[model samples]
Target: MRFIIEVLLSGLAIFLAALILPDSAASVDGFGWAILAGLIIAFVNATIGTVLRFFTFPLNILTLGLISFIITVLMVQLTSYLMGSRFDVANFWWAAVFAIVVAVIQMLLDGIFGAKPRD
Candidate 1:
């Protein structure tokens, strides 16, 4: 139940990102694409993302934890690549912007839903 809600919230976050960002920055075909992107993002974050974070801990600490956003940007880029035409990011800068938007949405949702921090 909680997992389902988190997935749906992720979908909403991606939908919000697609709506907020300009087409030049990022693009999503529609709600269906957003939902698919959300699922991919969640899966990648849970699996590969964890390992990457662990390995990059030094860089993360050196940057005062700001490097996590770059990791998020990479995850978004990976989702865009895996999804092909359905999701596209213009460039790394745009991916970073989109990542920030998604992070903000996630934070807001977590606050409202009282979801515990993952780490």
Candidate 2:
């Protein structure tokens, strides 16, 4: 139940982020594609993303957390690759932008829906 709601919210965030991007930085074919992309991203993040983050933790510390952000951008690229034509990010730099945009939108949505921060 909670997972389903989160997926929907993520899809909305993706859709809005795609629309918000300028100069063709990113695009989503439609709401359905956005939903599917959201699901795929969530799955990958829970699996491969976690391992990647764990392994990169040392480098992340050395880079002042910049490596974590690079990992995020790479994940966005991977998500776009996995989704093929339906969801597209122009490049690594654009993927970074898209990731940031989606994250911001998701955070806003979570706040709007009364999600409280964990202590």
Candidate 3:
């Protein structure tokens, strides 16, 4: 249930970001593809992101977690490529912007939902 909610929220965020970002196009299918893409991205990030973060822990620490931004961009690019859809983003900068927007929205949602346990 929580996973589904997260994916839906992410899809909404991506759709919103697509509207704001330049040269970024998403389908007009009422966010169906966006929802699917968001789910795929979440799965990939949860599984692959964990391993990548573990391996790059030293760099992550040195960069003060900035490397995660790069990872997010890569994940978006990977998702776009895998989808093979017309939802094209112009370049890496736009991709970065999209990632940042999605991250901010997701963070806000996560905060509101309090999915993570307090320390």
Q: How would you encode candidate 1's per-residue C-alpha lDDT over 1-119 as one tens digit per residue?
A: 78888878888888888889998788899877888899998789888888999999999999998777778788889999999989998889999889889889989988998986665
Looking at model 1, which ten-residue stretch has the lowest summed lDDT?
Answer: 110-119
What overall lDDT goes with each candidate model? 0.87, 0.88, 0.73
Expressed as tens digits, the lDDT of each residue in 1-119 for candidate 2 is: 67778888999999999999974799999999999999888788778888998998989899998987887788888999998889999999999889989889999999899675455
Query: Compared with the true structure, what per-residue lDDT tens digits does model 3 show for residues 1-119?
Result: 76677678888877777776655433313478778778778777888887888899899999999888788777777777777764555557777878888778778877887785535
- Best-performing candidate as measured by TM-score: 2
Instruction: List residue ranges in candidate 2 displaced over 4 A.
Output: 116-119
Task: Output the better candidate (1/2) by lDDT.
Answer: 2
Cα displacement (Å) at residue 108, model 1? 2.8
- Residue pairs clashing in model 3 are none
Clashes of 2: 0
Those runs of model 1 whose alpha carbons end farther than 4 Å from true positions after fitting are 111-119
Name every residue pair that clashes in candidate 2.
none
> Looking at candidate 3, what is the lDDT of residue 7?
73
What TM-score does candidate 2 get on C-alpha atoms? Answer: 0.90
Model 3 residue 72 distance off true place after TM-score fit, in angstroms: 1.3
